[model samples]
Target: MADRIISGRTHDAYMTVRDHIADGWAASVCTVPKDAPKGEELIKLDTVFEREDVAWKSVERFARAELNNLK
Candidate 1:
């Protein structure tokens, strides 16, 4: 299980968390990569949801503050 999460493969960033929610599970940010994706200085926070507002907002805040370094 550990081998899958940090296998150094490119992922859609927030898709794991979204999938967790969709499958009726609670999820939170565990880690984020610092290396920028190709040409971008910051990876886009491309998270969306129909429900799970609190969890989604928490992730958005965390991504903006911790990952993207945005105020």
Candidate 2:
């Protein structure tokens, strides 16, 4: 299967964990890009197989650490 944008969260320098919580992807692990900074842990989100937009909204509401990760 192709790599999907499971998570789309932004960390403020660092965050403990980032994962997908939709379409059976809630427990899926997030693999950041190779270029991602070491200290910068991105919030990993799993997009629905064919409903990416819907999945995004779920995660965006799940976390509210201050930073608008959706934007």
Off by over 4 Å in 2: 1-50, 65-71
Tally clashes: model 1.
Answer: 0
lDDT of 1 at 42: 39
TM-score of each: 0.33, 0.27
Worst 10 residues of 2 by lDDT: 11-20
lDDT of 1 by residue, 1-71 (tens): 01112212432233234445354434344333534442333334344445565656656465434433421
- Return the lDDT, model 2, position 2: 33
Q: What is the lDDT of residue 68 in candidate 1?
A: 36
Give candidates' CA RMSD values in order.
10.2, 8.6
